[model samples]
Target: MHDEGEPGDPDNKSVNSDPEVQQTLEVVFEEGDIRRRKSSLVPSTAPRPDHRRRKTQCFVHTLLEKHDGVASEDLNASYEGLAQERRVDKDPHSHAEQSQHSRLLTKKQISDMAFGIRELSKKLAQIKIMLHVRNIFILAKAHDETLIKHTRETTDWLLTKDESYRVYVEQTLEKNRLFDADGLLEKNPNYRGRLRFWTNELAAEKPQNFDIVLALGGDGTVLYASWLFQRIVPPVLAFSLGSLGFLTKFDYEQYPQTLSRAFTEGITVSLRLRFEATIMRSQDRENASRDLVEELIGEESEDHHTHRPDGTHNILNEVVVDRGPNPTMSSIELFGDDEHFTTVQADGVCISTPTGSTAYNLAAGGSLCHPDNPVILVTAICAHTLSFRPIILPDTIVLRAGVPYDARTSSWASFDGRERVELNPGDYVTISASRFPFPSVLPLDRKSKDWIDSISRTLHWNGRERQKSFKEWGS
Candidate 1:
């Protein structure tokens, strides 16, 4: 036995040789797997400080309307110029007032700003990746074929150079599976092989199996992607690749490296609150049982009944009851959980969540909200009443809004731009918050703060230019 034990291979690198200290290293670079195909990026606008600017100007205008454009413009320009000088000027003590102004940011505000800045940087990285994802998703349908062609060329280059991508696919889909797992892919390379995350295959396929979805698009893509996953939602990593991205956070260059760390070091996951919606119609009393069942459960189909049911829905944006193409107003009733708060005779009405504040809500003159808040914004599109104004509601109340059909008026109701219903006079529609919140992954650790900060930088919210350009110095 002693003779048979020829010396154990001392040169072996296997973990079994030395259990106390194990080492891991890559053998083959499997980064070549992601094949190249064109993808599409949904259109997105960058965050703007228009709202903040408008508000500030409104404040300025309210206080000094006579000065109008000139005063506000010159004052803002002066602030920007001074702020820039403070930043680049070598001597910190050169301007005592400037130093004091910098100090006025306060410890808490500074801490908050720092946190926001860091988060925004990370988000910018994610946005780049998200844009790539969008290019992959939307390349097929882009209006500009040249842009599509350009993406295809770029993707091919990245596929060859992006080693981390190959690692992602390889590590995610392990080869040499000795054991069997049910309902999993049969080690197929098509699913596991070189998947170029673009075209129809990516648009339809990876969604089923990807570990984390990195949105390389913008806010529109994020919204679209989140809406697709009705159940069993996965985490998303987004990088903005567009000119301006509210949802896209990561930078494009960070892809190869950041994704490397994400795989080797995992990524931070966030839970975004999503709201589900139910649609009900007026004049359908007989199907009330089914309709009511769906109402409580947020089901999709219309509940058919003998009586005309009202049109209402638990919507992500808002339940819109409007008079389409007509110069007439829509007499709509707004019902709270306990009782009807009031009625508004207007062109249309919008009910939205805090998450949707940046969306259609903002367009209708509603306030932007921090993503975490649970509040509803009720705005009148064009109200006939002089006193008609937008109202804020507690998120808890289920808001019922619809034109009274039996009132002998023609009105329409829409949910998230789809599923339209017409309310006959005297009939009514109902709306409320669905039980489910759209759960989206922010990708970065500081998604909310970063989102807010992006609003500042991209929109220049309350903006005094952080710095002065060389051209400005000549001015």
Candidate 2:
């Protein structure tokens, strides 16, 4: 038997030679894995004090003093429970370990993710390829109550028409929505907000986004819509509610098919030319005083005022420089491309685009030119010389008409039969082909054949008693 004080004894207490303490110290120092694990489910406690008591003497003693009833055996049981839970969490077959493995994606998962991305790209390409039809802005004559009523009737009829028409209108309403021109929304409550109203109140608003413009009045209404969109005027489907629907040839009764076809199959769009004219004072090299010019351009030119933001004016038909309140004929000097062309001593001058050939130009004895003709028609309104007739010039050139400073009186210039300005002595008006052109939708059934039909139907062109045949004349 070994003595109790033996130097190499296996049961020495003072020398601290216990195998459990030695094994624990070896695990702590050699493994170097003394980290605290956190868990919400388990109650936390201070670390074990067997090996750490010397290093953390103050902390262990303080805990022992505070919890006087806690025994060493109870603390050992808690530490063992925590260690078992941690070991299970790190086990390869445990639920927590399996969940960690699941987060790491495999090759098959990466391939499936790539395939999903490609399918999404293909679907987006198909969506981009589909044809898109948007909103239709409708314009009706404001002052005419009867015409406004008729327009509302047409809209209501469109909803209750054949299933095709109803579906088209509903889809259009859904995709892009419908809008009424300015004040028409107030008069008709049915359209309230479903069909929005746009006016000058929305300062910067324009009709660029609208796909098409539908006019429910006469040819004048169609012209008004053209003026509304000063830039690129969209295709217009004009319905004739006037005495003679010459320009507005589409019958309101047969609008279901025509409107649908315009929305789907599309129609032949007639590009009608327009002209922009600017009026400048003659004597003043710069510009005349606004008050002086406004006084000279009195209330007589009130009809010419438009809500256009820019001071410059655009005209679809013609500009007439006539002798206004002046007894004498207007002495006008015309220039082509800045070169003096001719001096016309006439009642007035009618500068018209081919689209306006049948307007004031026709009534003034000017030849009717096709709308497709790219020419400017200048006709004299009762000229002094019989030889000075109407002439057609290429649209590529700019024409400037001036009232001579030595003229008998000042002349008045009107645009599209409206917005008139007084041309004082030396005052001149410049005319050129506008960058924007009107896109007019032609009739599907008759197409552009309505031009000659309008001339014969409206003007009764060349209507006369049939000439006697040669056989009847006894030749």
Model 2 — which ten-residue stretch has the worst lDDT? 21-30
Pick by lDDT: which candidate is best? Answer: 2
Say what the RMSD of model 1 is: 22.5
Overall lDDT per candidate, in order of appearance: 0.46, 0.58
TM agreement with the true structure for every prediction: 0.52, 0.59
Candidate 2 C-alpha lDDT tens digits along 76-103: 4464334333211011123433332211
Off by over 4 Å in 2: 1-132, 157-193, 200-204, 283-310, 472-475
The number of clashing residue pairs in model 2 is 3
Candidate 1 — what's its lDDT? 0.46
Residue by residue across 107-207, what tens digits does model 1's lDDT show?
Answer: 23323433442343333334322211111222211333443443333344434544323212212112213211111224332323333333333433334
